[model samples]
Target: MERGNRRNALWLKQVIVLDSSLLIAFKIKNDSHHERANALMKQVVSERFGKPSITSYIFDETVTGIFVKSKSLRLAVEYGNELLASLETLEVSEEAFREAWKIFSEQRNRRLSFTDSSTLAVMKIHDIGRIATFDEDFGNIEGINAIGLV
Candidate 1:
């Protein structure tokens, strides 16, 4: 029904969007979702299902997550570089980016960060219906589905 490769496989969440949580999980071995995230990463790289895309904002979040976890700026940078090798980065206009950031910041929900909101916004904008993330809040978004659950 999707009219692409796999042709009739409508159950698959094609055109996946990468999330910072999943990336962080992949990098941190001790993370709760590490194994699942690692397996998802392997699938993304090996199977090459639709070009997995991430926003610049999410990229920053991921790198920052790595830094906070490892407490090493150098290691964070290295991990960011290694992680970038597997996905596509999506860039948006400054005004749009700022607006999304502002809207998410005003929301009082502690579980969903500004970065998570931005990830949702980007997914909506690009029609990316699936994401690789541990955040269940993503499922609340109308059109986006977060995969890679452990």
Candidate 2:
């Protein structure tokens, strides 16, 4: 019984998927969601929780968008680099893709964007039950749980 409990504890500490909104919010200091995202990130990075992970696609999407919108290139680059460094990169797998496709098909009328679909895919594949996103669309996604601030 003790061994089983220990195993469950260990499994619960595994990686949790990080979303692009979280990174973007964390990087842009003035954004309304910045503080919320930062607080959530701190918990993820703390000793008791699992490490933060995101797909490479999310990485590119966030870093590019953040930097592009920033007036100060240097500051944007610095924040973007720091945000990227804090995360563990996960490569999207075939299984993830299939699951995302299924979600998309089921919600075809909703018109879920590719970005959110990909994130949902990664979450389903990795058994990640929570996502740190500021977008409500993520919450609408079935199967994948979203941790949006809304």
* Tens digits of lDDT, candidate 1, 1-150: 346744524323456778888888888889988888888988876656655767888889889999999899998999888767866677655655676687587765546777777766666555568887888767656565567653
TM-score of each: 0.77, 0.74
Q: What's the C-alpha lDDT at position 46 in model 1?
A: 63
TM-score, structure 2 vs. true = 0.74
Rate residue 64 of model 1 by lDDT. Answer: 96
Candidate 2 steric clashes: 0
> Which numbered prediction scores highest in lDDT against the true structure?
1
> Candidate 1 — worst ten consecutive residues by lDDT sum?
5-14
**lDDT per residue (tens digit) for residues 2-99 in model 2:** 99886755553476677777888887888888889888877867833466677877877787768776767687677657766776777767777777
lDDT of each: 0.73, 0.71
